[model samples]
Target: MKNLLAKKDGELLVSRIYQSESTQFEVKSCLIGGEQVMVIAGPCAVESEELLKETAFKVRAAGAAMLRGGAFKPRTSPYSFQGLGEKGLKLLARVGEDMNMPVISEIMDSEDIGLLADYADILQVGARNMQNFALLRKLGQLNKPVVLKRGMSASIEEWLLAAEYILAGGNSQVILCERGVRSSEPWTRNTLDLSAVALVKELSHLPVMVDPSHATGVRSLVSPMARAAIAAGADALMVEVHPQPEKALSDGDQSLTPRGFSTMMRELEPVARALGRRLR
Candidate 1:
């Protein structure tokens, strides 16, 4: 079979790839693969109503195009704070509605698809479930856009093939996210592969975004990696921002403080402009 995501003499081989269009589509007003470098920022998990709301407002104010929070977190440890479930989803939706920004949340199971679709503008499939064929096929049937994260150990071809699962199921609104992958490196949380950003753009017509926060567990590395992702040709960025990183219930070490997020946004503007993309 021929490669579905390929280009021949500057022409895309597949028209079904959503980002192949000259004009990009909007996910509830936030445009992807457009001239603007879309930014989605929020806490890694929804710990409390007050914290979530505050983080949402802060990220929105800092020029993020959308808000992201985990209602059902998939932690490695059973003792870890495993999100607030439905209540957290409700809070995320309310905060987004109140702030007038699109909201994103992860959906772990097929059963929660309906509930998550109702609350989230974009349904995310975490890295752990990247190759969850059943879940990906189900998400493909949903009307909402899906942000498919690269698996911790998945290769570029494997990642695109996983995306094919969703596209083959008939849903074309799929956004690819590179959140780094597990590696032998001990310094950082994950070894961020920025090359994937450029390679994906060349191979596929899908809008690709990077998760610098998850890519590097160190909060200090988020800004530089985010800049590098954009410079390497990323369509958007999903950063974990919190009012108080130290107090955040999950991934606190990698989460950026409100002030830190603001500074990064400001610094990102020139970089985006240099690449002929606007930073909204």
Candidate 2:
């Protein structure tokens, strides 16, 4: 078998089929690839209009390039909050317009792609549907950018192939996200694979980001993991932040407070600079 990754001319090569090609795109005023480390910080779900507004303004003030939230959450349990649906998307659009920041939200059903694309600046395919080929193909047909999260149980090859589905369909504007994966250890919510961050950068040209909030499932661990992700060559970071975690309707345990997100941004500056990257 051939090596999946290698070094060429002092640069890492990821895969023969998926050769590394730098993909750069703009989100409003933020440049995704090249030298800028994009930070996308917001709540896990849009609980309320007021809360979404508060988190949006705070994260933007903290230098977040884009705001992220879930309009259609796919929960393990049916009884849990499933997001606010179109109402949440509307609120997110309003906030992004008012704040002059682009917004991203999860689109579960392929049927909702048009509606979501109309409101959200970017469409996110959550981990649960990373291999949903039909959805991936549909996203490929759209002009909007899609953020594809790595599945909890998917291997590196499998994850890249999933991205292939989107690319083959004619849309090359894809962003890969590493949000940790299932593991035997029960101490943390999920075992974050920092190695995958490095591997993805070597394997594909797609811009890869990390989700430390979901990866660690602990507020305190978020900052450290986020810092490590930047140092490890992640192109961006998607963090979950809420004004008040205790009052959040979903994923409150892993959500960071506004203050916590600000501090993390500050601490990441030196790390980003050392690596010759700028965190805006």
Instruction: Using TM-score, give the best candidate's number.
Output: 2
Give the distance in Å from residue 106's predicted Cα in candidate 1 to where it truly belongs: 0.4
Model 1 Cα displacement at 186 (Å)? 0.4
Q: For residues 1-280, what per-residue lDDT tens digits would candidate 2 score against the true structure?
A: 3554443543332243445558888877878888889999899998888998899889888889899889899999999999999999999999889988889999999999999999999899999999999999898888888899999999988788788778777887789999999999898899999999897776688899999999999999999999999998999999999998998888899999998999999999999999999987
lDDT per residue (tens digit) for residues 57-176 in model 1: 888888998999999999999999999999999999999999999999999999999999889999999999998999998987877789999999999888988887887787878888
Off by over 4 Å in 1: 1-23
Which stretches of candidate 2 lie above 4 Å from their native place? Answer: 1-20
The true-versus-predicted C-alpha distance at residue 32 of model 2, in Å, is 1.0
lDDT computed for candidate 1 = 0.88
Model 2, backbone clash pairs (residues 3+ apart or across chains), number? 2
